[model samples]
Each structure stands twice: as C-alpha cells, then as structure tokens.
Target: MAQSRKKAVKKSFDPQEVLDFLRQDELDYPAGAKKFGKDAIPFLSDLIEGTDENLSMKAAYLVGYIDDESVGDVLKKAAEKGSSTIRIAAAYGAQKRSPEVAEAILSRSLEDNNPSVVKFAMKSVSSMKLGKKLKSKIDHISKNFLDDDIKNSAKDLIKKIK
Candidate 1:
C-alpha cells in the first residue's frame, strides 16, 4: 500500500468578490476580504470615495481590517473629506487605529457639518483619552451646535471628560 500526501492549496478571490463581501451591512473582524490584506486597500479606498454612499460607508468600515498605518490615513481622510454617511462610518472605523490617529480623525468629525458625524465622533471620543483641546472642542459643541441631539451628546461627553 502506498501512502498519499496532500498539499494545501491557497485560496484566491476576485477583487469584485471581496468588494461584495465588504459591502455587507453586518460584518465582523476577520472578514473574508481580509484575506487580501493590504492589497485590498486601493480597491476599498476607491469604494470609500465612490459615488454610492452606501458602498462608500461599508468600505470605510471595512478599511479597518487591513491593519496598516496607511489604513489609519485612509480612514482619517474619509472622516474629514467623505460624505456625511462615510464620515460617520469613518469615525467608528477609526477606533481601530492608534490613539493619535483615532484622535485626529475624531477631532475632524467633531467639527463636521453633519450632526450625526459629530455624535458618532463623540461616541468614539468617549473611549479615547480626552485631551484639553478635545475637551474644549466638545465644550464648544455642547454650547453651540444647532442640533439638539449633538448638543446633548456633547454635554454628556463634557461631563465624562471632566
């Protein structure tokens, strides 16, 4: 009797397939698209900056799975420059980056014209080390933002910061 040895085969995914996976509404870490690693960054960035707000938002969240310093840059940029929906997703996605990177993104989000982005930023800030500048920014929002929800959230965050 002869014994047989089996060799493992590497699985490959088409870029479109990975994009489809990342576009899902509910996803956790170790997402199937993560198998592509940094290679997925460009594709994901395109989607984040793309026309479809829904896909852009999902891509922003999925960017965190790449685990690269550039990933922080991408999320931060999306937080500052993308549409309101993407900014909200970017604010949450940024929590996975380093403290400084996350703070940079959150700071921009705090000033976003969209109240929802500011609210999401406040939520992210609650987990970060609130600095004097951030505390000041939140204080300003608590006092001046036009939206009642964001103003209230900023007030709550100010209490937490103190």
Candidate 2:
C-alpha cells in the first residue's frame, strides 16, 4: 500500500471576482470578500460609489473590514448620501476606522431618518470612549427623541459612557 500526500493550492486574489461575489444576494459573499483586505479597497470604493445599491452595500461592509485610512472619506460620503442600507453598512465600516473620524460620521448618522441607521450609530457611539461634547449630544438625544427605543438606547449609551 502506498500513502499519497495532498498539497494545498493558493488562489490569487481577484478584485473583480470579489466584487462580483459581493454583488450576489447570498449571505456568505461579504465574509468571502473580506479576505482580500487592502487589496480590495479600490474595487470596494468604486462599488460604494456605483449605482447598484446591493453591491454598494456589500462593498461598504467589506471596505470597513479593510484597514485602509483612505476609505474613510468614501465611507463618510456614503453614510451621508447613500440609501438607508448603504448608510448602515458605511456606518459599520466607518466604526472600524480611526475613532476621531468615525465619531464625527457616526454622530451625523444619528440624524438620519432611518431607524436602522440611527440604531447602528448609537451602537457605534456606545462602543467608543466619547468626549464631553459627544456625551452631551448623546444625552440630548436620550432626552429629546420621540422614539422610545432610540431614547432608551441613547440613555443606555450615556450610562455606559459614564
């Protein structure tokens, strides 16, 4: 009897193929796309700026996992102007960047009309170590928001910050 050894094969990273995978409606594509890291930033940036909302959202999520600082501005822009889903993805990505940059973008997202965006923003706010000014803003949100859930989230975030 002879024993055979199996060799592992390494596949090259293809930015276009990663983008295509992200564009699909399947749940695993984003995780699969994240393996490209900084190499995927350019393609993800283009997708974030593109017209396809589903692909753009997935790109935004993957861009967040990449550790490139240049993507911050793109994520901020998407968070400000993209659709609610894109905004949520952008917010998630923005939180992975520098806290100073992310804090400002997340703060602005708190004003978004979409509850999901606001909720994501609140979660980001809670996770970070905030300054006096930002804490005051969260306190204000807790006091003034008409939505009970948002108000409670704000209040809970304030408690966590303190």
Candidate 3:
C-alpha cells in the first residue's frame, strides 16, 4: 500500500514537494519544471497570467522547458499578445526550441516596442540561419531603428543572411 501511495504522490500533486523544491536557494526551475513535464502547463500558464510580476515572468520562461507539442503554440501566443515582460520571456523561451520553431517569435520580438525584447530577440536569432523574409525585416530594422545597438544587431544579421 505504501508503494502504491508513493507512486500516486509522485505522479499526482505532492504540494509539500513543490514548495520544498522551488524554495531551494539554487532552485533549478527548469529541472523542477520537468518533474511534472507537460502536466505542469495549466498551472504554469495560470501563474504567467497571474498578477504577480516575478512569478509570472518565471512561469513564462518555465513554459519553454515543457516537453509537449502544445508548448509551441502557447509560446507563440504569449510572444505575440502578452505584455512586454511576457514578450521578453517568450523570446528567451523561444531560444530553447528549434530555430525553425523559434523563428517567428524571434522575428516578431525584433519588431517589439520594448528595446529589451528586441535586444534579447536579436541575441536569440543571431545564431540562427535567418530566412529571406526575416533578413529583409532585419535590413529594414538596421536602417530604421533608432537604437544603435539594435540597429547594429540588425545590420549584423543582414550580413549573415546575405
């Protein structure tokens, strides 16, 4: 009975375990997040949609680590419609996925109003072999963006794309 109970607790919610694991000083959120794998999505999504600033941001990034098919669409939506904070996290999270999978989020983030989002998105896309559409957008950004850092990043991307 004890073995079955342990299995149930591990598979299900052991509230105390979550508190203990997440509260650790060196809390490896990615590792802890994968504990529940895809099952943690609804809870993490709630936290991202919640009003708490820090928690929302953390949850937003954690969603990227979920090994599930649904995570991509979820990240894309957040990258597109979420607040600047979530957008930034989405950019960061998108980097965890394949370049092809992450391309759209990175491209949109490069066009974001938030400089931080644009900056981080540039960093994410920097290593990817950008497609023509994205290269053209980068060229435009290089020519039009006011921030030298972002403009420089766009210019760099243009060189690589060519």
Name the regions of candidate 3 deviating beyond 4 angstroms.
1-10, 13-26, 131-133
List the pairs of residues colliding in candidate 3. Answer: none
User: What is the alpha-carbon lDDT for the whole of candidate 1?
Assistant: 0.78
Displacement of residue 161 (Cα, Å) in model 1 is 1.2
Writing each residue's lDDT as its tens digit, candidate 1 over 22-105 gives 667677645643666666788889888888888787778778667888888888789878788899988887677788888888
| Superposition error at 142 for model 3 (Å) | 0.8
lDDT of 3 by residue, 1-162 (tens): 999977775687544565455445565767866776666677767777777666666667778877776777777877887678888988888878877678878878877877788877777776555545577667878899888888987787788777
Lowest lDDT sum, 10 consecutive residues, model 3, at: 14-23
Q: Which segments of model 1 are wrong by more than 4 Å? A: 1-13, 23-25, 131-133
lDDT at 1 for candidate 1? 17
Q: Candidate 2: worst 10 consecutive residues by lDDT? A: 1-10
- Backbone clashes, candidate 2: 0
Best-matching candidate per TM-score:
1
- In model 2, state the lDDT of residue 43: 71
Model 1 TM-score on a 0 to 1 scale: 0.84
Clash count for each candidate, listed in order shown:
0, 0, 0
